[model samples]
Target chain A: MKEVFTMWKNTKMVVLTAICGAVYAAVLIPFKPIPLIPGFTEIRPASVLPVVFSLFFGPAGAWGSAFGNLIGDFFGTLGIGSIFGFFGNFLYGYLPCKVWSYLSPQTEPLINHPALWLKYIFTVLIASLGCAIPISWGIDWVGLIPFSVLANIIFLNNFFVSLILGPILLFTLYPRFKKWNLLYSQIGEITSEKTFLQNIGFIFILIGCFGGLLVGNLTSLGHFTGKIGINLIPLIFSLILGTILI
Target chain B: MSIYLYLERNTFIHRLHPVTKIFLLLLFFILLLLFSSPLPIILVTFFLLLVSAFSRSISNLRKIWKLMFILFTFTIILWTIFLKNLNYALAMALRLNALIFTGLIFLSVTRIEEFTYGLNKLGLPFRVSFALTLAFRLVPSFILSAQTTIQAQKSRGLDLETGNLVQRIKKFIPLLIPILATSLRNAELLAIALECKGFGIKKKRTSYLDYKFGRNDFLTLLTIFLLYFLLLKIF
Candidate 1:
């Protein structure tokens, strides 16, 4: 997390951030005309970039994902919701690297082995949920779209794109990045050992994100009769707290 | 491929300081949120239209008119089907349009340099701002390269359009690999270029563009504040 800020001081990281963002936005803008849900989500093959770049560029990739999505929104979807979109995409890029560091440290992210493949799948799933939860919650809070509708759309969109494309991109590009000394591990400090509290924070993230999605869906869909607005506060808080601690 | 919405004009809105423009955009967001009912939303939409006209950037709105129309209709239809409330549907649609129009006006009037400079003035770090400006500059070129990659792949008999949704998406991998490889190579070169140019040597960096708080900017801020207070009092 500290590296997310400190990386800015290094010119190479800054350049990597700009490149990641430009590439992400470059892919995103072309798909704008073909929306899966007009004014909401779209066919975002660009969604895979954050996960792949996260594993490669680390914090620079996170900030790039944030700013890239912001640039994409500037094409037309820029609005109050974009503030949430920025942070959501940030988590989308941030969580994979963080989770990967904890789940399988010091190993190549290639999907050669079955266990590594499962770890990659789980990492992408968390990152997708990490992105979907806050964005749906924010848009729903703003009364633009329902929580159930947006949460499901965003989670599925991010999950599938990253799941399919992430490993392939990683397999093709990881060695090139490594050979060029461009992997985040080559540029930035290797992540330290996971602390006890970070493990606790990981649990909190799982509960908060999964619970937020389920409760938001149920409450918005009328399976639960209570107000989602009230129920989501603590979950959102836990999500935020978990990100910080992680 | 040219995605910038900034129009070159000498209108009043264009003359306002960049920071003022940023504030004005935020003000529009708050106003739209505060007034969510149909009538108030209509009033805000009308007000935004007037601003667009005054800025002489209504033509810029034409670029995204299709998106605006589709979204407007989709939001209404979705809300109507889900909630069975026509008035709420209309209000939501108007609000979304107003927000989109506000964003279009902001982009139309402010250049990317001005945007980053304004953010820097608003306390963003210089390095971050530089990255944003660079990203903006790089996007179109990357888009161009991506287009070239898609064409090359298509020339090699890749079928992008004739597949199912998942297959169509999967087809993008061939296009993505080359683009990613080239972009990474370019990124390495860019990093070295920046480092050689002493990109982060100084704590304070200077810009070629200078912004001043002119009378127009002050008047714009005063009017916005007055309108906000009036709305607060009434609503």
Candidate 2:
């Protein structure tokens, strides 16, 4: 019975995680005025779902959340992201989950001072070793994959310095934030607590509810126009606010 | 977009709505998946350049030149070494040149406001349209942030300039921490602001920017569509 419940919870978490990621990716479309970060990269913060999921559900939850991010890319109008992005963001979620799962709540997210640096070091290492070659080749950027090995080696070795700096962000001196009450009022204790199960459920539920709205709007507002860039600030700001306040 | 872009403004293409331009670009993108050949592609490039000239301001020529000098030169060398077919290489480079500039023609002149208005007219929601606006502004903001981060590292005596191939790459290690950290913080801020504004609510939004469909808009779309159709039929 316990196993059955765990499986059910896992399924729910995965579905929810993907939905949030999809929402983050999909909500980006109306901003047709802005060119994406040069070569199709954007500063997507939907990772909160994955990070939180990894913390709670372990590796499988991490996997589900990571893969779930393609929701927006697949459904959106541009569809350029759907093909390359499936794997591009998958690992982005997986690494954090793997790392955090590798060490649970008993261990602090920060191994040293300034949690930000360690996170960066971990990210670069994962991108180089786990993602770069596999992603480039998997996505059919075969020509570009030649540099992956070199890129990974050059990247991972420098992780030491940044790792030392990252701990400052976690618990040591990180700001408690002013907007926590906004998020806390509507949301339950499930997400607020640092437990693995609550975090997984909260992350997925949030993404689903959040990302779903944009899709619903897209269906209704068939044609969009006007200062696309300026309009986007609010949407991005909304996502940030949701994670913090809720 | 960077200040480097210069535009050539005129009636036909310029008058066409940004939403229309975006759709046409999409149409072309879909068209490419369906069809790609040298003659048809080259003809398309020629038409794009001609249209591009009329599409924006006169100042965008500098961007065209810089792209040709930098991206063109780089691609040519890379293609030649790998593909090793001089003709194929040159042809590919030219194609890239044409596509980039034509897109730049649109990018240089169309302000975020114009794009938003055009997309909203095309039936996209107010929130989605707004996100487009933020993404554009974020580019330069992100770049400035990256540059400042690098300079700070330099001040810390990172000495990135004197590094080897592996070591030179190592210099970038400092960037991911700060950039990603800032990004996470920004994400929280962006998400909240959007929700409070009633983003993603199902409703017809008011068009803040007025768009006029003059004689030029229709004629231009028809002429291009017809030309594109004819070209497609030819192949």
Candidate 3:
């Protein structure tokens, strides 16, 4: 949270934000037309960039991911989806460093310690799930795709790609950045205090995720047609949750 | 920089104000999504295709059509498997097609500068718009650097083509560093250049270009507004 203000005040961080955004869009635009599941699933090697950049540039990475996804959408899937895509990509690039640093591991380079690899995997999975939920859920609520299908597809797409490529890039870049003292973790202060607002934010996110999943399951099982007032409950809950987090 | 979709043509659609055309695109696109019935969706898709043809952007539209065809087929198959209704599948496919075509047609006709001008006139700050333009402008350099890096790595016997998913991804790591280094250097130079030009020196900046709302924009907006209501009444 403090890093965001730090980013704003620093000219170098501002320039890096724009550069990272351009790089992200450049990596993604080539893959825009190649849909793995045709309309829905995409083979985004660009998925790996977010996690890496998040760990590398911190808040700048998140802003870059948001803007990059917005620009990348112009290649094909733009309009309403871009709104959700922005937040979703922000989470994708944000949660990795947030969670990783929150866990408070003192490892210099993640590759130096084999045990920290699990943390990397865990970070990537959480980030991927965090990103997938908003995007798939938003698109489904907008009546574009089935919640279950899109959610699982996005989850798998981001998770596996990031799991595979994210580490390799991290491992490759970490030592280099560490030697250069360019790693975000090295320069930026990782907020360690668990504030009351953050706790409430996490609680809202938990409720949103659990409630949304239950709604998706119930809708799929024909228990509800997704039109019940109850469906909006989770959406509204997440909206509040999102507002808090932002 | 590779804004390859916008064809430099003198068609009437191309002549329409960027904001007006974007408004129509959004209106029709929303209408396309609002209707659940196959008839309206199909009608919207047809209308979009017709507009593309009328604009003489058939060649540009054809490129997107190829991709859209794949999307349509994928939608039909997926929906058929999940929903077990061919009619629903077809309708969903049409909706997806409509979404893609709307974007394609809009980008094909609107120049980047015109779109950015429209955005600026719509009250977006100059810095935000400049960042957007910078991102787009830098894309080709990033792509070129990526290509050069890949070529450089390939010459050193790195086989990116014949690897499994993990291996291929591993191959990409070598390419990432060079690209990042080059991009960072370029960003520094750009930042210096921008500061030298006295960016952010003034609170309010001005543009030389002005896009006026002519009769075509008015007629187009009115017609689309009426058509939206008319469609709602009919459907």
Candidate of highest DockQ: 1
lDDT score, candidate 1, position A135? 89
Error of 2 at B47 (Å): 1.6
Residues A1-246, model 1: lDDT tens digits: 688888998888998899999999998865433356446666788989999999999999999999999999878778988998999999999999988888888877788999998999899988998899888888777777778888888899899889888889999999898888788998899856789878987887888888998888888887887766777878888877887777
The lDDT, on a scale of 0 to 1, for candidate 3 is: 0.71
Indicate the docking level reached by candidate 1: medium
Ranking by TM-score: 1, 3, 2
Which 10 consecutive residues of model 3 chain A have the lowest summed lDDT? A30-39
Give the residue spans of candidate 3 off by over 4 A.
A1-11, A29-42, A105-111, A175-190, A209-218, A221-236, A239-243, B1-3, B161-164
Shift of residue B143 alpha carbon in model 3, Å: 1.2
Q: Which segments of model 2 are wrong by more than 4 Å?
A: A1-246, B1-10, B30-37, B56-58, B64-90, B119-125, B138-158, B164-204, B212-215
Instruction: Output the better candidate (2/3) by TM-score.
Output: 3
Per-candidate TM-scores read 0.96, 0.52, 0.87
Backbone clash pairs for candidate 1 read none
Tell me how candidate 2 scores on lDDT: 0.42
Task: Please list the residue runs of candidate 1 whose C-alpha ends up more than 4 Å from where it truly belongs after superposition.
Answer: A31-42
Chain A TM-scores, candidates in order: 0.94, 0.40, 0.83
Model 3 alpha-carbon miss at residue B144, Å: 1.5
